[model samples]
Target: MLTFTNMRRVARRAVLFCLGGMILTACSGKHEGAARYRTNCGICHHGGEGMKGEIPPLIGRIDLIAATAEGRHYLADVLLNGLNGPLDIRGVHYNFSMPSFRNRLSDHEIASILTYLAARGDSARPPVFTAEEIAALRAHPLPPSAVADERRRLDGIHRLP
Candidate 1:
């Protein structure tokens, strides 16, 4: 015993609700990378801000380093193997050991984290790290000191960011 107008009103409301939910899901997908980063890297890096001069901020640093091909590989290697020893970044010296996640996280997870950082940076065209790229770097494992050495070499070559 329902009127046709009443049924149309209910259908319109349902459609609107469905559309709203779709929009929310699309927005959430954009931040999926950030969520992944929070779970894996936010503990120490603190959402790329880092712990002042001790941990090194990734906001400006990561994007700049990733501008070059070699720097991109260095980042993947660091994530896969880890980094240690004294490191100087933006005139700040940090001596700490970053744990390796080679066994803990997959290539896609690592790529997502790096890609998220790159997107956060102020770059005209930010580079995206693919799972394939991460896999290639993962093939070669290095000690923490070696990673540090690579950083030094990269810094010397490009002056870093």
Candidate 2:
């Protein structure tokens, strides 16, 4: 009792529904931080690895430096005021410069970016990075030299809070 046209229409509807479902499923799995990180940080981090050693890799190693509150502050400072000069990352000294995003990105965006990084490096729950924390550093943004100095300080004190 069914016409061929009706059968074709039904088949097309089923196919369209399946396609829509697949698209929705794929989109639902993407993380907000991961997306923003990809847009902003990924250009350099490249999924946590600096391409061809031009930038130091941050994958799986952030926990060592970010274990304490001081370390966290150091990180926020670096993000707020870009880092320049030589850095010894896991024995390999990288002298590449990281530009500051203080002017370009808001404190919240920076926090979101860091949150993504924390999740990546720790594989645990994201750190509680508040805007107040970012604002505290806003009063006097450090230069890359100062950031490097802080890095040295971390090395000296063993990065304790």
Every candidate's lDDT? 0.87, 0.75
For candidate 2, write residues 63-109 as lDDT tens digits.
Answer: 55566788879888988999988877766767879988889777877
Error of 1 at 92 (Å): 0.8
Q: What is candidate 1's CA lDDT for residue 10?
A: 93
Residue-level lDDT of model 1, residues 48-143, one tens digit each, is 889866887889777788999999999998889999999887788888789999998999889888888888899987788999999988989999
Candidate number of the best lDDT:
1
RMSD of 2: 8.1
Q: State residue 27's C-alpha deviation in candidate 2, in Å.
A: 12
> What TM-score quantifies how close candidate 1 is to the native fold?
0.81
TM-score of every prediction relative to native: 0.81, 0.73
